[model samples]
Target: MPLSFFSGGGETGDLVRSYDWTSTSLGAAESWPQSLRTTVSTLLLSPVPIVLLWGEDGIMIYNDAYSVFAGGRHPRLLGSKVREGWPEVADFNDNVMRVGLAGGTLAYKDQELTLYRHGRPEQVWMNLDYSPVLDEEGEPAGVLCILAETTERVAAERRRAEAEAAVRESEGRFRALVNASSDVVYRMSPDWTEMRRLDGRGFLADTEEPSVLWIERYIFPEDRPRVRAAIDEAVGTRRAFELEHRVRRMDGSAGWTFSRAIPVLDGGGRVVEWFGAASDITERRNAEAALAELNATLEVRVAERTAELQRAEEALRQSQKLEAIGQLTGGVAHDFNNLLTVIKSSTDLLKRPDLAPERRERYVAAISDTVDRAARLTGQLLAFARRQALKPEVFAVCDSVRALFDMIGTLTGSRIRIMTRLPPAPCFVSADPSQFDTALVNMAVNARDAMDGEGELTISVGAVDQIPALRAHPAVPGAFVAVSIADTGSGIPRDRLEQIFEPFFTTKGVGQGTGLGLSQVIGFAKQSGGEVMVESEVGRGTTFTLYLPRVVDGVRPSDDSAHEPLMDGHGMCVLVVEDNPDVGTFAVQTLSDLGYRTVLAATAEEALTELATDAARFDVVFSDVVMPGMNGIDLAREIRRQHHDLPVLLASGYSHVLAQNGTCGFELLQKPYSVEQLSRLLRKVATWQRRARIMSQ
Candidate 1:
């Protein structure tokens, strides 16, 4: 039978049968050996690349895989000997066949071969294995070959090898660069206990040992704990570590260094080691220390200079004060001497019995007038000294200025034009209404004199939110009512502007001015919790501004309560406490004149003892604010606690006791008061006591 009858009838099987193999040494397929027929059928049916060479000629019979591997020479080379089919690699195939026919086996991994598969010689790589086939007698009969192409895989391996070579060369260059740098480069174990220097020298180069603690030896003793903590933190967090600290240098000298490092993690994200660098910063640290020391020294010098300047300023102030005192003494002595001469001459004239009644009356009147003038002079001096008692009240500044307009006009006269600019609404201030009027009148008179009794005097009132010029004045910060008096006059000289407020520092000729006007204005303003400022130009004019703290309660406190007709004391008993004998005698006499019975005490203790003896006998207790043993304010407090019904009146003439401990809720009666003022106060207290007794009954 033909080999076609034994073929499987697939594409490869059909190709085997249709081909004329009778011309070959294998001859007709029907005359082939049974062993050869069986091997041919097996080769044609296999999916892998399989081929068989039969007998001594090595005629090829291959499967579909092998046919594809054969390329364009498949069908023709199928019936040819291996030596003839692969002419380009004929020697290699010849050896393969020779070894197989001798009952030996051969194998090649990625073996190189050349063939004329597509009518052109081509080089290829393959994995090949050849084994001998045996006959029924167990002797080698033919060769069986198995092969797979490995061209793509072999090319990939060659590219990978070239890339690895480039990486190795780059690593060598990186190591060389690190070795050349001045900064130290190092690597540490995962826990940072061991360090290996990559550069020639490291931050710890002073240590010669190769132990794990080699780096620790160079760390400053004080900085070792912090450095070790940082390393442990980096390893724990698997993050970068950085710090600046002092270190011991290789030359056994102290130095500063900035060190930084980052962890190298393994495949499981666990820290494997650390890579780091350190740079010396000893010079920078030394420079910073030197700069700090220099700054401290400069500060000490500046403080010494400031203290010296303050001492010089204080001395200048003292000299100015002494000059002012001398001026005040001269002015007071000159003015008082004139008044004393007039009084002495008038008294001597009145003493002559031969004087006419009218002449004697005129002389008496002259003496009385002299006394009044002296008293007025003393009052002005006290006002300038800020020692005069002020009765402060919440009154509208506009109202006060408006009421004083006619009076101011009378003082300035017809030659001077008095213009008033008052606010439509009342601008209230907490101050003494009488003092406010006096200050305004005093400024008007000054303006009149400056203008030679003929000029425009403008008095304007307004509310001020803040006064920057008066910030250093005694007035507290807040809203204020400013009463400004401006004059179109000859204006004050610039040199005398500051001296104008000093007592008796006037520029007027002898007997023309007392020079206490502006000083009184300043004293009143400061005592009333306010300030006074003057602005004057040599050619233009002068403006005096009085800033008084504004009050929210706009209603003016009425004096009608004190204006009531004075009542006789009706022999009501009075307790008088005075430290001075003369003052006590005067007080007792005044009370007696007011028709009141009086009891005198020298001190607050004596007064308390008097009150304790007969609290009911005394209708009122008039005590001096300052006395030895216990002050009047304390006495008044004790009287209130013991006898709540008794009315206590405090009296002071610039007492330190009143200055230190205010009035202590008792009504204050300023000293040097007239009999009318005393009578009025006593009657008011007596009336209140009578009303209280009536209510209690």
Candidate 2:
């Protein structure tokens, strides 16, 4: 062994002298190359945090400054490889060692990486300067690095940014308030059902006293529905209300006003009333109307000018549009996710041959409910443009695909390999949520068949601007999420490619396949405003891509209600009023099954007749909102009038009346509800009513 020569490395120098370098990849210190010895001696005396990563193994040697930076790692890290030493950043260090040993130098300013200091992981930023250390033969042997920590500097910058953001937000809110102000001021109830006060400023009729029919009195006949819709939307969200619509003027002629309203919240943050103002925009509207007519006639001339400008702005606008996505959720985004877990789990459990009937029924109900919910749970999602059986939801493509991995593995079997090429950021799409899963599963199964139970399948998801003319179909240009499933297997023939999507088209012999898989994929794609594409090379592989229209502003994430087990209801009698005989029967039977006394009424009039018989016996009236005569809302109002103490619950799938008027301050359950949802809501509403009665007393 060489004599003790690490005299200048402080504590590290003595540690290096006593270290058993023979156990390490670097071997004995006595047999070390002359250049490494010189490099080590030079670093040992330096105050800066310098480390020498020697040889292919990146054997680490550092000065006292670097030792202090290592914290508790110190002496143990002395002879260890750089990768094994900082295992958290092993990949990063591997790349560094690779470049340095190959005689290449690297420098990174404010390099951010997580490091384990003091035996716990901490994010750190460092300015790293790396260069190769040469041997006596003038060949690169190892990497030498100088590191300066900048974590604190980065944190300080972040703090400054947060403070700046708060100032900007305050300014923005102030600007909006100032801009939305107008001349004629008004106040309305939180529900906008009653106009509490209005100063029309001589433009229109003033309402000094509260009027329940203010909308009919103030808004023009043609504009009443639009006005009510806007007001209801604002009330529902408790947000600022803004509309520019026609209203009845004092002179009885139709005029326009830009009405802006803000919810006035109490100290507890509940909206107690709406404070609003209106600016007469009739003159501005007439001028805009004339301008619109002129523009309509000059479309051809302006189109050319617009086209030229668009060409210049295309790239910037495209990038800006993508980056602006930070600004915006559709519930049920055919972007639908999170529905598969229940189905998969329930189905797996159902495979047991000896499960008890009640237990089996519960599992069956879970699956049944999940499937039904796939159709029912619309949750502010875009309705299918074409009225179809599709329950389109906006869902994240990457996340949905990830959710299917376990199921996909079961379908593909152990012999086949599964891989994914997905972008780090989530890509979203609009399509039927249930059908999305079916299409992917169909493709995966097809891939398995093509591979004969062995080989590889890759699912790739990404955003694309345009799809080239695929098969016989014309090219489609739009933002789309492309989910490509590629399989390493014998591929389809060129001539057969066009016919693959045809229903009942199959190459399998006998009854091996139904041939509806690819058909479903194509059908779903077309319905979703997207397309399915196929690429194949004989004896090589096949790639099937299902393109879906991408949606950037996905549904806002809402916490799903915790579905506690279905509870047995007390003997709370329900008067089930459904217009449909079938639905009424189902509700009555379901209520009875769940330990509730049920009385069936096929019409709103009939329900009232039943209620008139013994209103005291019926604890609640569970009535459908949309019926032929009187309707559910009118019936609810009537019930409230006659039986002032009895509770009423409304249900509907798509009631334009409910959509415009909201729940009318009554409890409402949406259609296609499962046993759990129905049961839960019933118990909840009943309990609330009981508590309310007690509070009132």
lDDT computed for candidate 2 = 0.81
Clashing pairs in 1: none
Clashes of 1: 0
Which has the greatest TM-score? 1
- Candidate 2 lDDT over 1-697, as tens digits, reads 5446555677888888878888987778888888988899999999999999998999999999998889888878989988889999999999998899899999999988988888788888999999999999999999999999999999899889998998899868755654454456677888888876544244766644778887888888888889889988998899899999888776888889998999988899999989887778999999999999999879977898899888879977776555332221222222235567788888888898988899999998888878775653342121221223354578898888999999999999999999999999888888767778878988999999999999999999999998879666688888999999999999999999987875446666433434556766776677678888899999999999988999986773452444567778678899999989899899989989999999888899898888878888988889998899989999999999998878888888767675445578787776777777888778777887798789889
C-alpha lDDT (0 to 100) for residue 105 of candidate 1: 99
Off by over 4 Å in 2: 1-388, 471-473, 508-514, 553-556, 567-586, 593-597, 601-674, 680-697
Q: Write the per-residue lDDT of candidate 1 for residues 530-611, one digit (tens) a residue.
A: 7888888876899989888998767765677566666688899999999899999999998888789999999888887887
lDDT value, residue 643 of candidate 2: 82
Candidate 2 lDDT score at position 25:
78
TM-score of model 2 (CA atoms): 0.36
Q: Deviation in angstroms for 275 in model 2?
A: 97
Name the regions of candidate 1 deviating beyond 4 angstroms: 1-181, 201-213, 220-226, 237-240, 248-252, 266-268, 292-389, 393-399, 406-417, 423-430, 442-455, 462-482, 487-570, 593-595, 656-667
lDDT against the true structure, per candidate, is 0.81, 0.81
